[model samples]
Target: MSATQMDMLWMAYGKAGAVGSIRHEDDLFHVVMSDRREIGAYPTLEIAKGALISHLKPGTDRPEFRRV
Candidate 1:
């Protein structure tokens, strides 16, 4: 797998519950949270991005998947 292929993904959260998912793509992947909740299985990372965005709030100031 190339560098673009994400081996891991996380929903980085910020103050007041802001969230956004780190994205990368490869030939195939399965996205899951730190909590181990399955984000669903997709044939491609691009296809799963919609779900990632839905679970994220891009306008926050926090580092990684933390609830500050």
Candidate 2:
């Protein structure tokens, strides 16, 4: 299936404010922070999401991240 631009974009939000976003491009999931910093690219969206969570909240059991 062909994914639209909107479908390729995923935003991650935290309790304080906007955390970051994950964009699917060139068959890779790119994790970009709120400050416009490119974290890294992952093979899957799940992995990309986890990287964001880990970077934001390290050593936390339950790091809350609202996907938008």
Question: In terms of lDDT, which candidate is strongest?
Answer: 2
TM-score each candidate: 0.38, 0.74
Among all candidates shown, the one with the greatest TM-score: 2
lDDT of 2 by residue, 1-68 (tens): 35563348888866666778888888888999888989999988899988888777665353344545
Checking candidate 2 for backbone clashes, the offending pairs are none
Q: Model 2, stretches more than 4 Å misplaced?
A: 4-7, 59-68
Off by over 4 Å in 1: 1-27, 57-68
Residues 1-68, candidate 1: write the lDDT tens digits: 65644556545554544344444445444555435555766675555655654544465343345211
Q: Any idea what lDDT model 1 has?
A: 0.50
